[model samples]
Target: MSIERERPRILFATDFSPWAAQAEAYALCLASTWRASLTAVNVLEFQPGMNPEYEVNRLFLAELMKGATQELADLKSRVAARGISLHTRIATGIPSEEILGAARAEDSDLIVVGTKGKTGLAHVLLGSTAERVIRTAPCPVLAVRAEPSDQAGKDSHPCAGVGLHRVLVPVDFSDCSLEALEYAALLAQRSGSSLSLLHVLEPVSYGLDFTLSLERKRGEMRERLTQRLAGFVEALAGAKITADSHVRGGLPADSILDSARTLPADVIVMGTHGRRGLSHALSGSVTEAVLRQSRCPVLTVRSPKFAAGHRRVIPVS
Candidate 1:
């Protein structure tokens, strides 16, 4: 999966919201840098028979599409002015479904979407369109939050003037994490960036009586982790990508976030379990949490072995 070998096709999904606006900046920057074709997608979610107020829904959808179309046109023109070829798409269906459909139709190398960073009840009710896209998109998904506070290397737009200088990847030694590391290395090589592989050791809570035993156990584990990290870096020997490793103690998400801030990472590339339904709700997702809170954009790739089910084909009405 050498993204540099071929011309990349990037799909940018926007709802014309402020969050999506922020994402547009990233889309432009990436497209311009990679010399990739850029497609801007806006979906009109009009479920006809799902509601009793059909007339009201129809009127509202009409207005929504009208506005969305105008906005997309303006976006296309703006992107074109930046010297990147821009294509516009309007589909009527679920946003995630339509966005994924567009990605497939375009054979996109990456799908960029904006997340509102919703949590708690709002996340449950509204759901995360970005997360759904991440779970299902055939290609890697880059999630940009509406607003990120840590704008270390960012220009007026968070992603502006940045070219993935330093990429931080969290590795748990899982197959998924390994795949993410490979992807990150490729990205770093292409962008002339360095890679930082991070592993977080979750502390075991033991009674005071076991303090000595815990200290010895922690030492052994750290030594083992150090050896494993060395092996992982060795595997990328021929890649010619500069890389380093860090083993830290704390929660996985917290540790990853801290590393990103400390490294001042331009981007975070990590793998997701791609869990859904009850499992996802119960276990929660560290990747999703990092995506929600990370100041930098997070690119999530699912393991190839993780069957992404069938590619859903949403009909455009």
Candidate 2:
């Protein structure tokens, strides 16, 4: 499909948490950069214990929605001051499902969510709403971390190059990975960022491996990955950004993260199939894992291109 070079529209999901407010501010900053439209959504989950008999429950929910609307309106005003268009919405349902559904309906190019940035058992119990949205959203999800006030600027430093000045794309040779690389290449060409194309080979398990020699297997896989990377370069023969490729061995996410540090990437762009229910339940881990650990901001691209599926040809500034 042909893709249009229109303003990037971002949807910021909120839960009224402090981190959520911070996310609203940060999203506005980014929207300003792209001259994009911004939307904030709050998903209200109904509790079973709340009885219709209680006037308190009704009053509280009413107040919550009212406050959220005002806050989003205020946020929109702020963005408008910076010359970015903004919108707001409130919905009731499961938080993750509602956010993803909203993105699909709105046709947002990206979803920016604030993470309390939790880990360990707490993360398991709280079950990271941001993570779930990242795994399931129909569009790219940017998981913004709520850094300490002093670290805020530092954290945003990676995304400071206007567009992409250094784009890191990790490939698994899956359709999803190819789709991600294609989007990254487009952004790099538009913004003139040097592109680093990477592939991570999972280490062979000592416990189960009994077939080919380890060295021989590694050599063959590396060669194949090199050929594939070369194919992408050939595909972008006239693109502005110079491209380099590498294949390393380790966990996919870990290797990707390590390369980001070494490459000192400006942005990490990846893809998620928006898997959920049984599929998410089974995989249990996802790209959000990388977002949590990444030192840089992540831009996730999903579906429903603005025009055709062709790359967006943004004019050079």
Candidate 3:
């Protein structure tokens, strides 16, 4: 996709929670700014049971769907008046599954979700539906957390704007990281924000093949990162999005957080493979780590269509 192209549409999924409301507001603002359409989806969880006639169950389900549909419809006119194209949908099933299905069904460029950013016991218990959606969605997922309670109470008026002044993008020089950087650059361009490209030089043990000294390893790491950053700069030059790239030696998650904190970014964008089971548990750690510690909102993109020079740059609606 051309970096200059605008975001045409956004898929905003709401659970009707306070956090979801915050997500809707942010998504709607962007839609208006980009002149993009909005497709809002609400996933309803149905009670599980069996009935011979199923009459009562049917009535209950109908009422639930109708209420959600009405709520979305009400939002449509207001959002549309702000220059955003609006559509509403109601589905019954698992939240993550329904959310992903809605994105595919609408051919949305992005998924905007509101999260609590739960910590401690809550974090372990919730396990993060936002993370799951990030892994599964066809497009990028923007996880918006409610403003800190202290801040919210002080200011009755919700914060305004896309808040994209500085964006943090973590890179490993993998194809996935390249895809993420391209998307991030486009977003930075649109938002008129600076870009921070970071690479985490993970420590090497060499196992039993400990022939290379620590100094040699450090030298090798510097050379590899220099080549990577140079190539990245060239790519950005072609797209016209100015960016700063850096290499730091540490754990991947820690380095990502350190870079983000140093920049004090308004947003962070990254890519994931949507892994599951044992692999997912391990791979999901980086995403989990950043989301837990970062002060800014985070966007996660998972694209099966990603390829060198053939990446699809979804507009930053």
- Judged by lDDT, which candidate is best? 1
Relative to the true structure, candidate 3 reaches a TM of 0.81
Candidate 1's TM-score = 0.86
The sequence of per-residue lDDT tens digits that candidate 2 reaches over residues 42-109 is 87775556673589878877887788788777666655655667678888767888898998888887
Please report, as a residue range, the 10-residue window in candidate 1 with the lowest summed lDDT: 308-317
In order of appearance, the predictions have TM-scores of 0.86, 0.79, 0.81
State how far residue 115 of model 3 sits from its true place (Å): 1.7
- Model 1 lDDT per residue over 138-211, tens place: 88898988563344223434246455788898988787787787677666655678888899999887876887
lDDT scores of the candidates, listed in order: 0.78, 0.70, 0.71
Off-target runs (Cα >4 Å) in candidate 2 are 1-8, 16-18, 21-26, 48-53, 150-164, 189-192, 206-214, 277-279, 302-306, 309-317
Flag regions of model 3 displaced more than 4 Å: 1-7, 47-63, 118-126, 148-159, 205-212, 304-317
| lDDT for predicted candidate 1 compared with the true structure | 0.78
Instruction: Give the worst 10-residue stretch by lDDT in candidate 2.
Output: 152-161
Residue 317's lDDT within candidate 2 is: 17
Q: Residue 186's C-alpha lDDT in candidate 3?
A: 65
